[model samples]
Target: MDFEKIVSDHKCRSCIISVERYQDGGFGNIRVVAANKAHREDSERVFNHPFVPDSPYTDSLPQDKNFEDFMYRCACLGQPLHTYVHVEHMGLWVNMFLLPLESDKENIGYCLYSCDISPYADSEQQASLSAETATHVLEISIKLQGAKKDDIRQVFRDIIEDIRKICGAEHCCILYHDITNRKYINFCEAMNPQSPLQPDAIYNNEKFYDIANSFDSAIRGSSCLIIKDEHDLAWLESVDPDLYSLLLENGVKSGILFPLKHNDQILGYLWALNYNVEETVKIKETLELSTFLIASEIANYQLMKQLEILSSIDILTGCKNRNCMNNYVDDVISGKAELPEPYAVVFADLNGLKRVNDEKGHSVGDSILRTAAAILSQVFYDCDVYRAGGDEFMLIIKDGDVDETSIKSKIGQLKEKSAIDTDVNFAAGYYIANKGEDIRTAMRLADEKMYIDKKEYYAKHPELKYR
Candidate 1:
């Protein structure tokens, strides 16, 4: 075959890749057999060297397993293919196509590999998937587009179920990483009713993050991992024996794993186990496009949750802020949230915040506030405690969990423990209420008793009368 003339006929960067075929149906080293002037110039510009024909592809491009797999599938397997993928590690988008060619030698199979590389992703290229893929990906985007953070779990389950069916897999799951907290959150999962694999709580284990992270080496910079047979499993075992053992235990004989990523950040992983191996390319194409949209949705969900947390937390004391307390109060008042037959409302006002702020500084006052909150949290661990502005905190405790005597005893402990961080004291009071008692009235009574306790504290030490 006149491979040079074949490449020269095209104006774009085009080349011929030669694949060594074995009689046992396995492939060997893939080499670049020829390249056009356009391809040569592009290579020279990137590598700062003249393009040398008939050399290993790695001689010009980085050795990538995904690129190798695409070449083998097209040249040896005789499948024409097109791919638009983000090479995230390299910060480049690769829009490439492949077509099998007639080979003159029996031992050597050939393919035409043409590509366009860009720093920014092309919207048109990304939307150029097959009709079926585009339709399904669009459907996924629509489902995610309408999801709210609180309802994302159900939406994710629905999406994962749909993806599992599309892949003909026995089990499918999406696991997200809370990197800042070093935790794993199982977003959702779907298992075929007849699947041999049993449900596992492995993700909940503390050691699983280390096991999951080990897959980075096995993936080796590929867009996804497709493990089809024993050979792949052996490679996986060599890379991470723990993961390999777990996969076999879970009956993961064949699978495809895609990293859900957004803007170069890996948000999580999506995997389908015991999938239809015959549809490997199709699965890859589908997930490559779909996970892109899924990742965006997940990122949005994380952002929403993060904002809520930030808004509801008191930065100085690390307690629920007044806004959160107000919301809870409104819910109870509006009958959106129900209270038990008997409950206690408690008020705790810091005794010496103004003194600390006036004498030591606001920084020290803030530290003292944190210490006071820590004491309250320890004493009322089972109750709902909120910062009710300034140095006052309120707690709503269920009577079944504790009686008024226990509440008073806990408040005393809270005062004693406050001494652990500076000489702090809390003027606290509680009001026990039965059914039909209003929370606002309970709060008023608690606050009035708290003032009485404060007056007694000042009475004991007349020099601290200002408190």
Candidate 2:
């Protein structure tokens, strides 16, 4: 029977090695005579050549002196041998079985069968690994949960470092979603000491979004994506050269992208770059639990921020509420906050809100309030606009020259526009405060001037007064 034919016919990863004895009583070159389909593919990827008749074994394969000695002895003595081998460069652990091929009384060569066994191990080994992985996950969860609100970013950095180490990745990062801007922002990152990328780098430009969209499209409806190398993205490269070039320029040779999701929303993306195959597989298997915990922490952080905003934002006018204004005033009075020079205070009061509320209903009054807030925001886009009272709005502009005449002209235009659109009227006055003057004094002056303007408006339109 032909041993090479027999090895080729096997379903597993098997290769027949022809071992020749030299005239000097030493082993000669080892050559592969035949290999099965699985072994051929593995050889092509790992060694850059498939096993064929008279093909010399490549020197790039990881060398294990003990494994080579065992094969030599098995061929010389015509005995079978078995052992486990670790290929460090490839990050693979495999089981090997070597059997001598003999004809009559002479040993011809050795037939080798190799099977990847990295994912499986003895019961004790499996239990120990599981225990260690569980400990890591628990420790990370505890650290994130107990972290202070101000220290959450640091906690994320620590988590990224841990993930990078666990996955043996060259870099790891979290990309946050900027919903208002429709962009993805790099929130934080961890990188290997030798990596080219920097930590905490922000990516919000058009090129970054193009790359993100390509990855998002490729992994649509999938929980995670794993690209082995550039060849894996042939379609993407063909369809979008800019995106492909961007990724390559950023040193993304191979990586995985995991979306952080809550309910139906994608909160962000978790990225691991240039990890080895074994580590990538391990990460894919174990990351689901850890990512869930991370997503929960992110969601909790977002909720806290939203609560802070809601406490200070006026719902009807979409401006800072009285609570926020009072806090600012207290801060200024207590010397905790310093006002910038050349500041101005603008006071505005709706002219006929009570009449509209009494006759046209509170809904109409609310609409007018919202419209007034919008106009104030548009005119003083660079200043802080606040709803100081039920019918009063205030604006504070700092570090800019006060053009009172121009502001009054804009207000006049707004009055004409509102009068035609909704019969709404508003009166406004501004006071430019001198340096080292009390902010309260400026506010009082602004209010008195606003009252005078209101009186003039009522005198001009007495028929529009409240019933």
Candidate 3:
């Protein structure tokens, strides 16, 4: 199937469905226009499926392109798709698909005619129901839309509980794919009241590991399967007897595995077990939902991860910035349970940043700062290095025995070496923390010493400009 095209079409239909939801929690009827036979069939199947009561397409079919355009506009304006549907009883008005019951997936098509129940039914009553449905649909959309992994699991758990209440299939389990671990991990499991398999302890069983590995291989290969009859369950049982026993004890007779893939690369799988429907068809429905949810979630995850990385990184040099370095400083200074000797803080100020930036350009100045950071990191051990600001750097060297004289010798050598290859030069001074000294005082002392050393160096070499 041309899944991209399918997704595009569904996105369009979904926009319309959202507008319908806002019109009155789908109490009024809605219609969807399909791009092809497959799209229409898929929409209808999703709408009619008994287990998916919240699907947006249960009752509506699109009549015209104008209505489709209208729905898209509403969605753009922030109308959630699951909260309302548009419908006209007299003329061809836009209609949205809706599932009626919170637990039932079947669509009950209702238009203004059906909603216009008895004239005697007060306007107040109609308004109340409309408001209630709108609120419910909004809540459902918020819960399902852009959900995280935890959110997805919670929604599935709620769905399973609802299913158990309606279908008498008290025992259920969901296996969601953990992409990083390359395995299908159980998210939630609902067990029969009389079963010996304790719900809390079932996840700890070794059989879950075997099942996860088996599903991981299949998911990696981009395949989904349904364990329909006793034979399939028995086959899995033979691989891990404990899991089989647990399922059998809990009255689990069927299961469905749905692969989640992006661009033919399987990212994960979702396995639903012990539902009322035949294992095969339920598996198909699950595959559809899994595809939608996984695609949306992976996109969201990638975006969030990128944003997080960017937030912590320095945009210029692509390194850990001041914010991250501060945390590192705090971690080291606030020693472990047992306090040891205080560490040393090295304060460095680049001598020619303004000159480099003014004469050579800011790019060269930035390069010099980056080079200084690299040199300091290479030279120090167990230290916190920071680009304190433009052309200024700081280092927190832990538990070092170096005195003022030795540190000065090291800095002098680094400066002489740097002048040979690069125009970078910096004056550095370090102060070891005393018993009662704080960070600020230590830094102040270091800065003062650095300036003194810089002054003396210029005094001896009268030709060099000190400032």
Candidate 4:
């Protein structure tokens, strides 16, 4: 590697690390910082490496803090360390305060400090890269504050643009996993962004499960993997040349995939591609730390998605509940959830439900209510079903031409199957709106019609025996 080019471009000192087995089963690295103006090596001078303890540096430590004192003292006494040393242990990196002493400064009891420890983890000469990354993230987040959902996405795009400017990488993808859909949805802020993987807009449940399984296996085995590579690209080229060309044309080179995990489960994976960059694609400590924070953010977004789904779904019947109904209507009124030209609202009331509760036990009544809900849900085809109230259900059908024959057949089947001695009849009224009309008015009309139908039924069957 040409060290000078890296130094010039990134404006930071570079180091090559040689890893050996760690003492406590963790990884350890020996960093040999690039030769700069600061420390011209003298063959006669002796200096202790950062990793070693009990060097001359440990001597100045307070008696109360044994381990840290010993470690620093070791560095001071054993070697001529021109810069501060950092050690990562137990999930924290601690930087020791050290300075290079000049020949005149040593006699004068003073030394010159070279770099800022607060900006970077260790050293004065190397730039504090992670602090810079954090500042960029914070600035972007502040700009996105109080923005709408769409605007927030735009902010993310802007952030990625900044990243591209700094890192000179191509093809970054932010995938939002919909646990409800059991899929990974590609979220892009750019309007009309062409999907590279078309025909498969999202990776479904089975595919997500496969990725999750692979992730778990790798975690257990402590093995790293690159899911997509040149071979995969070649295969895609063989099968779908246009898609392959599209991917290549878009400057998608090598990609780094890290699973976004929450509550110990992988929600999704974030992918960043190298494109034309020649930097080593290896995961660094700083990048790993950033990934942890990113994973948390992604997890939070996924959690909100789940909460949104839960808000819409009825916990009891697995249908759109009252809250969902309200949201649906709001969406329809606001033109968010678009409806067909001719929409129909069917209001249904289960007859003799209160009588059943009065005669039979509440358990039986509960069972009857559940059965009625199930029947209504099963009878309605491609309609939004809601258990609006006790013994009252609502169906919002997008297709206005709901087959009356099919609904009658379903009611007949329920009447035959119901074991309750009382007549298992239900009063239902549907109001179709040909032109765009208020959903509330349609619902009210259907409800009034249902009551009228019930009244007529009771009036005609006055002589029939009551349950």
TM-score of each: 0.91, 0.62, 0.43, 0.58
Better of 2 and 4 by TM-score: 2
Candidate 4 error regions (>4 Å): 1-132, 143-167, 175-212, 216-253, 262-265, 276-293, 334-337, 400-424, 460-467
lDDT of 1 by residue, 1-467 (tens): 78888999998789999998877666788999899988888888877888888988877665776677778889988999999987756778888999999887888889998988899989999888888888889889888988776678899999999999989999899989888888767789999999877646456545688888876666778788778877678778887788788788766798888888887788989999899988888788999989988998888888888899999988888899999999988999999888876888999998877887888898888887888888888888887679999889999997455576788788879878876666478898888888577889988998999999988988887876365
Which has the better TM-score: candidate 2, or candidate 3? 2
lDDT of 2 by residue, 108-193 (tens): 55646455457343433322334556677777889998899879999999998998888888888888887788788777788899
> Where does candidate 2 stray beyond 4 Å?
1-132, 165-168, 178-181, 191-194, 198-223, 228-246, 276-286, 330-338, 403-422, 437-441, 459-467
Indicate the residue-level lDDT of 229 in model 1: 72
Q: Evaluated with TM-score, which candidate comes out highest?
A: 1
Which lDDT tens digits does candidate 4 get at residues 374-434? 7776677567788786777898877635555655565565455553535356777777776
Q: lDDT of each structure?
A: 0.84, 0.71, 0.50, 0.49
Question: Lowest-lDDT window of 10 residues in candidate 2?
Answer: 120-129
Model 1 clash pairs are: none
User: The CA-based lDDT of model 2 is what?
Assistant: 0.71
Error of 4 at 27 (Å): 17
Ranking by lDDT: 1, 2, 3, 4
